[model samples]
Target: MASPESRIIELASRIAANTKKLNDYLVANNLPTPSFDVKGPKANLVPKQEIEVQAARAAIIDDTQELRRLVLGPREYLMSYTHNELISQQAITRFGIAHSFPVGSEASFAEIATKTGLPETNVRQVIRHAINKDIFVEPRPGVVAHNAVSRLLAEDKVIHDWVGASTDDLWQSASQTCNALTKYPGSQEPNETGFALANNTKATVYEVFSQFPERARRFGNAMRSFTEGTGFELSHVVDNFPWGDLPQDGVVVDIGGSQGFVCFALAAQFPSLSFIVQDLEPVIRAAEKQPQAIELGTDRIKFMTHDFLTEQLVHGADVYFFRWILHNWSDKYCVRILRNLIPALKQGAKIVINDNVLPKPGVMSKWQEDRLRSMDLTMTELQNSHERELEDWAELFKLADPRFEFQGGELPKSANLWVLVAEWKGE
Candidate 1:
């Protein structure tokens, strides 16, 4: 076996090799080199179908993370890595520094301060910190301009909302998580979460957000950004699943499908299939107002207000789809959601779940695993819920009712979310 130093050197070599591969792919494809400059390529989004590019990118990410860990060593990393970066990011976002800067044109620190009503000294400090993270750039002595990352924050409303929700809402909730755990030990109630504690509200995050529509909208937009990002494309669901196998004019009920986005994608592909998108009254109403919803045709796709926890009213549907829903609730509520569906699930009806499935220890790349684990903790903080492992998902169906055939799951290639299916064998 090689020594740790030797292993690190090997990783460094791999990193360089992969980096060159990625660079070559980009150049050969006439893709612009990755840069923080505002004028850099707009196609910065993850390569969807480019197999070689994807492999190179993945190798680079994995090797780079390992190399950094080896260089820092365990002790040094733990001591040096602090929450200061998060705090600095929060300050920049809260002060609207990214929004203040022009995309192509540079602005002096003083001008940014004036636009954002932040102190010039403070603006310089926060902006410089963000610059260190390659978010914004200082073109000259004290002038600031939008980098590509900062330009996205400035121009993309959904990305802006993502930052706002992450730094403001999620950060506050995370800060109070420990206190919440101490206060409400073993609590499973969503209302007893860190979010509730941070806001000093008895209501759950959703309930509180309901009272503050703008905040709710921002959070929704943040989720939209997340779903649209990288491997979370709706096309993955349309292509990876057996939607084409369903009978003509078969009903697909979308439980908690906020804007019928998934349905919209499915409808476009499986033209013979119809859909019922069920959500809260306001969400359903909002879905109805969308031009895409109208174009899909009301007869083909209908939006209805229905609380999923109570009972699923649409009976004998070919498939009941839950996308990014069950993970928000603890196992108890997840079971309840399943049990509620039983009344409507006809024999052999499919219960399809599209969500994160936590990987076993050391199975995934460190960077990818870290994100999944963070999401698991986030579920805990927000709703006392957690991301389930494959076994946990299987067990959930078993616990819901034995009559339900708990089919195994698959993580589709090029998809962020796992697609788990269970068939109902009516009792």
Candidate 2:
């Protein structure tokens, strides 16, 4: 019998096959091949509906990553693990380095330094570090030019906001997480988190950002960018849920719904369903003034200002929905928020949650799984909160009230978050 192929060779073969498949699809459709160059496509070229193509792409990603680690071997791979991966990107975002020069124009280190108010050597160091990450390019000695990534940073305000908020706020908080744990071991209070320690404030992350309007706006804008991502699109929630099964006049109360994006998406999909979007006074006031993504028919959707941490004010709504809200709070707070709805709920009332659900280890590609798990830790760093397993989610409702019947959850196909449901049995 022939000897079995080595793992490296197997990976290489798989990568080659997938690359050819993706390339053929792109070429057949006259789409531009993937590139890091200045003129690469802004959005992912592969349509989400192209399931086989997406699988091929994912296979390539997983194989290449595994092959890379295999090539590096164990000790070298361990040594290659980086802690300051975001430092260069953070410096670039903080200094507005990408905006210092216009896209399609090359600038020398000194020119960039002058524009950014940094020393020439400092500019060179930052840009050179970023270049290695494909954010920019040095075509020739001392000449810096835009790549697709850096150009996107220049052109997209929301993308810039993501990098800025990520590096400045999230990164700083993550660095202090160990210290927070050391100081307040096993604390579940949001204000006792690394965010508070890093910012030197007793307030939660939300409260800290609320104190700085521009900072809050930037953080909000960053979250907005996430909704535009393939995994977090509001369409995922609208398309896969059982909203059509409700009564013709079924009501949905969006707890802590910021700007009503989820409601807007759902309303467009299920016209018969009415929505009440509840948030803080400032958020509701701002959302009320702004035009919605979809036109709301008369009385189809209402905006109300109410903190979710307090009692739920909407009585007898069919579905009390939370999209990406509960993960920010500890179990104690989450249970409190759930119990707050008890007074308003009727028999067979549903509580719908749209949030990240931690998966079984090794069930997904390491590349993908690592990102999700990092987010779980990110919750800890920022708010002393966390992503939940399916059981953990069920446990919350049980802890809140025995009448809450956990109806279980299912992650939508190709979507990063899961939609979970519980029905309230009347007392």
Point to the candidate with the largest TM-score.
2
lDDT score at residue 8, model 1, on the 0-100 scale: 85
lDDT of 1 by residue, 1-427 (tens): 9898699889988888888888887788788888877887655534768877777787788888777878888898788677876766777667777778567888998898899998999888888888888878877899888888888877877777888899889988998999999999998899998999999998998889989998898998897777778889887788778998998889999999999989998988888999999999988888898999888778889999999889889989999999999999998999999999988878999999999999998887677788999999999989999999999999999999998898877888878899899999994
Score residue 368 of candidate 1 by CA lDDT: 76
List candidate 2 segments past 4 Å from native.
1-5, 268-272, 291-298
In model 1, what is the error at residue 377, expressed in angstroms?
1.6
**Candidate 2: lDDT of 335?**
93
Candidate 1 residue runs with Cα over 4 Å from true position = 42-46, 247-249, 292-298
Residue lDDT tens for model 2, 1-427 = 3233388888899999999999999999999999988999876799987999988998898899888888898899998878868988998988889999999999999999999998999899889989988899999999999999999999999999999999999888998999999999999999998899999989998889878999999998997787667888787888878899999999999998988888988888898999999998988888876567335843888999898888888998899999889998999999999999999999999999999999899898677788889999999999999999999999999999999999998899878889999999975
Clashes of each: 0, 0
